[model samples]
Target chain A: MIDPLSIFLLLLSASTPILFAALGELIVERAGVLNLGVEGMMITGALAGFAVAYVSGSPFLGFAAAATGGAAVSLLFAVLTQFLLANQVASGLALTLFGLGLAALFGKPFEGVKAPPMIPGPFRINWIVWLGLVMVPLIWWFLNRSRGGLILRGVGENHDAAHALGYNVRLVRIGAIAFGGAMAGIGGAFISIATVLQWTEGMTAGAGWIALAIVVFSNWTATGVLVGAWLFGGVTVLQLRLQAAGVKVPVQLLSMAPYLATIIVLVLISARQKFSRRAGGAAPGSLGQNFHALR
Target chain B: MIQLVPRSEVSTLWQFLTPVLAVLATMVAGGLLFWVMGYDPVAAIKTIFWDPLFGMASSYSRPQLLVKAAPLILIASGLAIGFRAGIWNIGAEGQYIIGAICGAAVALAAYPSEGMWIFPAMVVAGAAGGWAWGMIPATLRNWFGASEILVSLMLVYVAQRVAAWMAFGPMKNPEGFGFPGSRNLQQYPSASNPELIAGTGTHWGVVAAAVAVLATWFLMSRHIRGFHIRTAGLAPRAARFAGVKPETLVAFCLGLSGALAGMAGLFEVAGPAGQITDKIGVGYGFTAIIVAFLGRLHPVGILLAGLLLALTYIGGELAQLMLNLPAATVQVFQGMMLFFLLGFDLLTRFKIQRRVVA
Candidate 1:
């Protein structure tokens, strides 16, 4: 009695946010910068987008505000990790905490307020959904076929080599991080504006973290990111379907499916990478390491 | 042009001074934040930093400090060990929840039994539950080469869901007219963790926190395992050459931190909270991370940082009551403190120099 088309559509909607965030993280990682503040940026975007859309009566303006908000918060991470030479992990964590707090403070008024109506695009899906679908190929083209993408990969593979070649490492990473932030913000806005249609505290939940896992699951590849997001989205939609079908399992247990699935995927990917050793798509050589220019 | 130059050795003086500087910086930033939010910055700062310890309500708030600080210190002390060795167990919040559930289940099962063995059994169950939960990430990281940070954080959400399920279903208080919570553990004398003194909020948890600090200090400074942990964090290759098994260290740090976090949760449920509820997670686990960093991952430093953060919690609440400041203000303050700390931490290992432009 299960409808495949409806489930597929739901899966697409559920996966779009993760797709956007993961793609952004993929670019950042490709540039050898691991900005773990995607969650923070996403939440900030969610609130900013919701608030702006609610006040302005335009979802486009909301999405714009979300991207700006996400980028602005990410710039804080750039300042800390890129400029100040702080630990990437710690700085990213702090960014998340700061973003969460800031969003909560800003979102107090937006609580229970309905989000503005979304403009239906092709197939009656929101434009952002279509935009997300388009971005996969676009990002793939950018990372694989573009000159900027080559430089980003070169930097990630070996910052020293890139720096030796007179490339500005920090500038490239800052740009990637900002783009990642903007994408994460848009992803977060998708949740508030297109999906949930209302603002709430901590609404992004673990979607950002899931996106982080998806990047690793994707082995830093754009196509792999799409697959991973779909897999996770499938799990999310399936779990909801199971609940709707009056399964014997508790709803709480069903809710844990996506997170548990992410962990399982991560473990499998890591184990495979460990055993394969000379696998083509290994993590970036200089990922999570701060680059410093010696005088 | 100003530039940062890496030093051969970290300055001992800056190591201690950066935390103080960060605290001061947070105050200024937080004051400005309050000002922007349409409140008197001076009054808000005073309420947040001063009122909890020395204001008119000092007598009441003094004890509350220990109550607030006990879990933070306990959890942070454990977290500091793992952080020292670079084994990030960010899922202590999950461990804390499981520990509380396990401990509460023990007490709930022994409801009418007036025996000394019940509390001890609960404590053991709490620690064991946390250890078991911690092992998931440890084992995954060890065997599968997974990232503990993501795995542990993922578990937190899982634990939260499990806690919610318990509150709404199996653990719901049967005698409370369909309410979603376990029996009030505080009223159950045989299972309660009561304040040892009349006015002070001293309890078994506070004693345990103090003991943990001493124990961690001794381990980090005097023990070989602790030496291995520090060496592994500082020089992984050297530690491996010296026969320090990375797997063992990862397991030990995660397990120890998990146990401590669990004990903190158990103590909280038995003493202050008095019952297992869906909202049992008040973010002490996350806050403890900030405490661990603020204390420079040192036991003694963590103790002081715990007290300072606890002061903020109490003061934040006071501000909320008096000035109607949003509850999220304290979270922002804490986050700002960590941000400033990480930023200022640069001075410990590097010196900023103004370069001559030719």
Candidate 2:
């Protein structure tokens, strides 16, 4: 009795948040900065979006607030990693822990409160869903065709070379990190305002981490991020369907499909990259390395 | 204007001082946060940092420190080794859960059997389960160049689900109607891990933690493998030239950490926690990462860091009860501690010089 079209629609909606977050991470990674605090930023966005939408009665304002909240959180990461030269991994993890705690603390008032209604688009879908879809090609164009994009890739590929070429590495990376944070925030808002229609502590769950894995699964390509997100979305939708159909398997085991799939896909991609003898399978040259400008 | 100048050689003194500085900074920042939240910051800070050790409730909270710190020290010790070699295994929580499940499975299967062999067998099973879980990422990274951080982290969610399933399904208590959790191991004499000294929280876990600290100190300071780990992290190509295979190091570090985390879980399930429940993995694994870093990845330092963090946990609870602060305030304090720690770490490698612009 499961309708294929409805399932497709559900998958599309489900994939939008991850697509948005992964696309943002994609750009950040391409710029040679690995921000592992996507989860933190997303959670902050989720609460902010939900709280704002509830108060202002406009989902758009909520999304905007969410983006700002996420950006602010990422700026902390940028300050620590970019300006202070803290270890990127540890800084990012700290950001996540901080964001989660902050969100939980802030979200106390909004818990169990309903989110505002979403604005429908042409296909009876939320406007943000369409925005996420349009962003795919837009980001692809930005990363591949734009002049700024080339400079970013150049910075990622060789920060020293880019520096020698007179490109501002720190400024470019800070912008990229902020944009990634904003995107992650929007993605998180999608979960709160569009999908779940409510705010809950730790509700973003592992979606941020999943987005991180999807970036790797996509091999650092914008188009690949879309495919990976949709694939994961389909798995999630199908798992829910199986659970709804009174499947005998434990619900907990069924919930593990998406994560297991991520691990498996990561293994396959990594193996292929190994056999091909390429360094990091299209990873940015200076990914995760902090750039310190010397006079 | 102040300008940061990179130091030619890493400052040994700053390395030891940064953590202390970070802690003091966190106190100031945390107090400010509490004040902003409309609480008496002084009283709140005292309850969290001071009262836990010497306050009116010190008698009650003192024993809780060892109880809470035991697992942290155990897991952080293992995590520190892998972290030393740049092998990030963030999924220790998942391994910890698997270890607990496996250990509990051993105890549950041998129900009513009064034998001394049961506890030892459970411990072995627990370590093996954790080792196997840890191997997945190690093998993947070794053979395929996959990032262990993401893969291992993903496994945490999966392990959480598995733990939930165990609580609801096969491991559910049989004689206690339809409750979700397994039988209380605390009441089960054959499998129970009791406090050796009453009111002190001195259990086998504490003993194991002490042993792990000593063992790790010996290995990191005196062992050739430890030297190899340090070299690999500092200079990968140099380590390779020195005949250190990256794959072996990855496996060794991951396996060792997983085993240690697994032991922590085993000890926890067999002792204080006493049952397999859905909420058993209470983030000791993640917090251990903080302990590892705060300890500067040193074994002895982790012991002290573990105690300090445990103080926060106890003090946080005390704050929640006394000052009506949110439970998450402690989490925020811990996060800020890490943030300040990483920021302060900058001072260790660089010195600020006033810029002279003509």
Candidate 3:
């Protein structure tokens, strides 16, 4: 029988990566930029973090490297979308492809290698798990109560109007993209360094996509994202428990639970927004639109 | 500082020139990557681009190009239409898998039976299965306002699991010591999609891909529906005023593309792959997206782009054998090509001018 507290602990650990990624995406979307390369950046971070930690014998340094690596990859996207005025959707897809290939090329050496063991925090959870928990409230405050957030929301709602008010729309978006990349990096590192304790190709295995789903499920709210992440995490942990207990269900069918749950949650949220006669959906006005400051 | 000025009219010359420009830029960037990785850049490049066409092994590799490009062209032909109509159906991979499973189910059910109707029946089942899978996101988006991108992508994971389930459980071969794959269709004459002309790599899939190209060209250029699709993409309000229904366009585009992608899967399984397995999808669906963009969403362009991408696959393999390059090198080249393609697209839509500081 699965113990209640142990299962709860597993849920928290399982949820941390998506929590960090969704939080980062939240800020980026709030700033009116849709960066769909979270998976790419996360994988880059996974390899970099794992390699750095292996060489230096410190998981903290590995996490730092991951953040840096993720941001570096995001910069390619920023240049393409912001500076070159490329289509955001295509550019984001290109970034994912590029990052996955780049990581695989570099990660060849790291294959079959164990990541440096992570140190547990006060509650015997990994330190990064605690960090993800703390970041939820912190991000909530930043998005809901901060001046910078107001500016970001303004830019997202109406870039032309924000530009008229003398805000630097491109600058704010660049900053948000970078922050999103860094957060995604940490999340990816959490997978390699804390959870899996090993480096493997495609190890993130669509967690980044799941994170993207969680963002929508949260209705672009930081607190809502927390709930979405936990919901997903709980499903994952329970699925693993069922597998370990030798449940009669096919493993492949059992593996589909989290993805199916994401689709269901997304439909439920979207249905409510559609049928409830809510004033307006919480999506930022200028989401996915390219902005060029034309006078 | 440089400033971009929007062109009053898109430059026809730039439209034709940018793809070539992007290719050159990718070569340079890829050369740099190869150099940094401690390989002889020139040799690596030559092995990938030149050897596949003119080298001693060209006879063997040249025919292989058609085999590789058939599915990409078929899938991209469908996708390009939808993309032009402003509907994103990124779940073609899932649709493809479902189609293959459905098509293979027909054959599996008629195992050891002889009938000319088997292959045709499988094709219909494949397209229907794909169309059904594609409709999920279209229906959800129409009724519930869900983002089709996320929903379609989510289904890919679901489809993968379903494929795995079939491989291990219901669809496993009854013979051959309980192996987790179905009976090979290549061994079954009625169910097989063999190369029509030996040494030419011509098969039913290749023929289907050619038909798709011509059919989409006619549809997009000579049909009223195509006009509505273009109008909707350019201006939704104007399209509405012109009597275009967004829901119909969404459903039509998604359904059509999903059907094409499904046919590609059916062709692949019945031809090259020969059986249903957990790992049937080797990312043809995703790669087709790149092909659609690289071809500039044009039918003729897609043909050339599909061939070019097929060349890269062949070349990448040659390089892997001769130069000891990583298997992922081809993936990197494709990604870089797309990056350069998008980056260079700025030139096609705008005129860059040097800013004079006042």
- Highest DockQ model number: 1
lDDT of 2: 0.92
lDDT of each: 0.93, 0.92, 0.91
Look at candidate 2 and give me any clashing residue pairs: none
**Tens digits of per-residue lDDT for model 1, B8-114:** 99999999999999999999999999999899999999998999889988899999999999999999999999988889998999999999999999999999788
Candidate 2 per-residue C-alpha lDDT over B1-358 given as tens digits, one digit per residue, 9 for 90 to 100: 8899999998989999999999999999998998898999899999999998999999999999999999999999999999999999999999999999999999999997889999888889889888888888999898888889988898889888988999999999998699899999888887888999999988888998999999999998899999999999999999999999999999998898898888889889999899999998998998999999999999989999999999999999999999888998878888999999999999999999999897
Which window of 10 residues has the lowest lDDT sum in candidate 3 chain B?
A: B145-154
lDDT tens readout by residue for model 1, A60-166: 99999999999999999999998889999989999999999999987898998899888799898879989999999999999999998999999999999999998
Q: Which window of ten consecutive residues has the lowest lDDT sum in model 1 chain A?
A: A273-282
- Tens digits of per-residue lDDT, candidate 3, A212-254, equal 8888888899999999999999999989999998999999999
Q: Give the root-mean-square deviation of each candidate in angstroms.
A: 1.1, 1.1, 1.2
* DockQ head-to-head 1 vs 3, winner: 1
User: In lDDT terms, which candidate is top?
Assistant: 1
